[model samples]
Target chain A: MAIHALIFDVFGTLLDWHGGVAREASRLLAPVRPDIDGGAFARAWRDRYQPAMEPVRRGERAWTDLDTLHAEGLDGVLAQFGVEGLTPEIKRELVLAWHRLDAWPEVPAALTRLRGGFLLAPCSNAHVRLAIAHARRNALPWDAILGAEFARDYKPKPAVYLRAAEALGLPPGEVMMVAAHTSDLVAAAGCGLATAHIARPDENGPGTGEAAPAAPVDVAASDLADLARRLGC
Target chain B: MAIHALIFDVFGTLLDWHGGVAREASRLLAPVRPDIDGGAFARAWRDRYQPAMEPVRRGERAWTDLDTLHAEGLDGVLAQFGVEGLTPEIKRELVLAWHRLDAWPEVPAALTRLRGGFLLAPCSNAHVRLAIAHARRNALPWDAILGAEFARDYKPKPAVYLRAAEALGLPPGEVMMVAAHTSDLVAAAGCGLATAHIARPDENGPGTGEAAPAAPVDVAASDLADLARRLGC
Candidate 1:
């Protein structure tokens, strides 16, 4: 069957959420902590994000929307950074910054090119608003955005991929999941979707080995531009 | 509370499915039947579309997908055109062509711009494949794509819109339904969604008088770009 669509993993694939989140956090914190290192603050803020969500992701707690997760994460970051007396309003702003992260350099052009042939979509963990805001901010041309919120769970859950394909109205086989994280691809692949890995050298540190493992990928490229070419779109 | 997202009706709003279908049918018929006006055949094909889908849309029939509706419409179009010797494969090709129609000129840029301010999505009658294909063909940047296949009913139905908001993890009021057709927006409005009208000149035709009527619209604009500006995005 023809590869009718390419569904992306958004968090680290199209946009660098970690860097963006930190930068926005730092900017918001600048007015309050004139002497605070925004860079370090941003990083610390991001560090708390996942750990905060782990309970929900692991189902130890009931599913929480990212907004709630972000709020909790922000509070911990403020405490850890020794930034005192941060109001709930300011914390909310900091949490919302996740919606304004910048797109990766390769994103806009690669998405445009791929849109020429395949239906370019995203199967992301970001909530619907967050995902849409990120796409609009970066001008990433997505045909349709799919989020974990759509499935009521985060990825590497099979429901996310299966629901995405069902929403796209294509059975599992015709949809290809393009992701930087191998685990996400493995999950999509488990649902019978073809998988493509777009390598991100900057992600997960030099030795993190967080990229999806090699065997699961139907196609792998160094960047989105190369990914587009490899897909022959 | 602010309306954070706008979900659109695709067929007549962003893309002129009727116009495209008519154009393609005419082009296809030109060489073989020089005397036969293909435009009339195209209109005839589209004319049959909604009427045939009425039973399903009205809940008289068990829920059906667009592909089946298109097939039934195709059968009527062939008979009206008096075209003989149509094979099953040729009919299938024509039915699938509905998935590939071109979007309006203002669509891509308008959506790209509006997408900046709100979570822009599609609440469409088309299946996911058709929706994604139309977006790819036209570069329509959607945050999420919701199709009738997901709810198993066509537009003007509350269940479809309700299911969409539920999947979005949102309250119906926070999600706006944007469309050129007033009926879809009216239905969405009844479902407690904020409604916006992106008035397309081409969408205002004789048959559409039935679809467009005065309704309490939350926002009305000439197109998505105008909608974005008015929304202060």
Candidate 2:
């Protein structure tokens, strides 16, 4: 079947979740602790995101939502960073910051080009609201949004990708999964969706140095803009 | 709480499933059965879409996907039309026709505007794959793609809306639901998401005359572009 849709992994593929979180955390903590290693703190918090989903991903937990998981992970990051004197309102505000994260500069135009030829959606571990909010905030054009929430398991898991295909009403072969993380494409590949890898510098943590992402992908691009061109968008 | 996301009802809201199907049918039948009321066939076929979901929506069935329901409904419309000599391939083609339906001319622009402000996803009764495929074909920008698959239930049921919000990590009130259909918004309203209504002239049947949509939405606009403006997009 002709490729009809492109399912994207939002965090590193379209939006700069790592950079946005790093910046947002830097700003949020700056008022209290100027010495806070904003970059390190951001990475630390994000490092926990995948592991945090492990319990649910592994089926050890009865499917916790990302919001609650995010809160759990954030609480630990705060304590480890030795940040103090935060009110509940402030903490809640910080947690909601995930909703306002910025998109990479190339995303808007790239999305426009990609949409000309394919169905674009975020297939990610991000909470539905976070993904949707980010898309709205950043202007990532997607046809639908797919999340781990749909499968109750995070990406890199076959269920999530398969569920996404099921939702799109297309067989796995016709839909391609795009992500900056190779591990995500690997999972999507397992479910028969063609995979595209768009490398996001921030996601792999600076110079983990473009060591190939953990998953196997079909086409690798430098970013969304390149991915669009490769797909003939 | 800050509104983190928005979920929409697909059919009449995003794609003019009704109108598009009517137009396509007109083109197909106009050539062979010049005397056939292609418009009426279109309207009747479109009308069956929701009623077709009634079984799954009401818990009378075991949560079959929308494609199956559409097939069943398609068979009924075919029978009623007394259209003869339909092959299995033709039937399959006809049933899948819903997947290729066109969006209202206003959709792409309005969606562009709405996408500028909020996280947008669909909380529709359409199967996930169908929704995803439609978005790709139509070039909709959704952050997350949600469907009845999550809760194993259809819209009008609180579970569908609630599950979508929960997936997005937003409280029900923090998420908004947009649709051209009244009952869909009503259900979303019941779930506490802000609701917006778009007028779909072909929904009730061609020339049935567009009246005000059935319910009071937060804002009723000429179409999505108007909707985007009203939402501060």
Candidate 3:
């Protein structure tokens, strides 16, 4: 495939959301709710992420950005962990934890190399605001910020893949969806976009995420740097 | 107003489209049709630009990117100049002149410095593909591609300004709209976004564009670097 652009799954593929959210959740919540587990709070928040986007993806609700959806789901997640006593200011800071996510080590420089040959963007569920904040904090030299907000829907949906390629003025076949998730890669491949699997074995937690592609892909590598080398960047 | 992001106008503000388009059009057409003036031809194409987006801005036409509009406008421009003999491939390449346009000499480094302090993006009428291609060619350090396609309309439209602010997850007052044209900054100011005027004195031709704001703006400077320094970047 003649890939002209690489659209990434940012959360797991580029940024370590689980680790970031877990750390921040524990750091803030531990002072208030000493009995709560930071890892469990992070997982609870992430668990609600899909369900929050479900209504919008299915058109049951209007297009809502990640921060808004995250804020809307925060109370329920807090209750699930029996956490309390956090002020709205603290809660806002906690939601912004997603925006403060760090890239996997080797990602910044690797993406810089890959960018030499391909238009790089995150075709993630993250909204433009979160994406920009996250990219700036992590030093991602993306040629564009794209995906869900541009599509007005969430991932695993064909529109997300199609809209991103359209935004890049590329045919689906000329764009490659790079993700650590097998389901995400499969979804993109089904939409006729090329797929690259970047193994993020610790994305969910240690040894919890994909260690390798579970399906066919145009490129597969152990991490972002390896993926960059494989792509001849 | 606290400015968290700076959105820009592309054609005359960031890139020297007047010169670039003139050079390409003259280089290509001058060989076969020596009678046509490159300067006038470039002016003719640019004159058609506003008229082309007028229908869309007035809601008389569906959303269409600049590439399509430029391509459509090409035939009339060629006929206006009585030019002929360009192959389809040559014509396509000519249309891509917009993507290959270079930044004004001070723009690249000025934008790099500006990007250090605020989120930077093109709030131009140009679509994502056009923006990405142009930015890559010029080494523009944009955090995201915002504007037309994102708002589904051309600039000077309130949606173009407001939607761009929305995309950056900031209130209108927290974003600065940067452009050489007074009309663009005025439009942005009307939308409650802060405005910066960077004098592109030769944007239309030698000393043809604005040397200063025709109306009030939040920041007014001689050029982008001057503007950056004024903004403390």
True contacts kept of each: 0.69, 0.93, 0.93
- Model 2, B1-233: lDDT tens digits are 35657688777677777666666666665545666675688777767777777877677888888678777887788788877776677667666777787777888777867766676777888777677667767877666667588789877889989888877667888888877778888888888888878776656466453345677878787778887887778
What lDDT tens digits, residue by residue, belong to model 1 across residues A15-125?
777677767776778787877766577667666766776676788887677788877777677788778887777887887777878878978988999988876667887
lDDT score, candidate 3, position A143: 84
Query: Is candidate 1 or 2 superior in lDDT?
Result: 1
| Winner of 1 and 2 under TM-score | 2
Candidate 3 residue-wise lDDT, A29-92, digit = tens: 7678877777778888888888889999899988999999999899999877776788999999
Lowest lDDT sum, 10 consecutive residues, model 1 chain A, at A204-213
Stretches off by above 4 angstroms in model 1 are A29-64, A76-84, A167-171, A204-206, A209-216, B1-6, B26-64, B76-85, B100-120, B138-153, B162-176, B196-233
The best candidate in terms of lDDT: 3
Per residue, candidate 1 scores C-alpha lDDT tens digits across B1-233 of 48877788887788877677766666655555656665566667767767776898777998777788888888777877777776787677778768767887777887887766676668888877687778767877666777576567877779889877865668999988888878788899899988888777556345443233367788878776777788886
Better of 2 and 3 by DockQ: 3
Residue lDDT tens for model 3, B1-233: 67889999988898999889988888888668877888899899888988999999999999999999999999999888887778998899889888889899999999999988998999999999999888888989888999999989998889989989999889999999999999998899899999999898888778899999999999998989998999999
lDDT of 1 at B120: 65
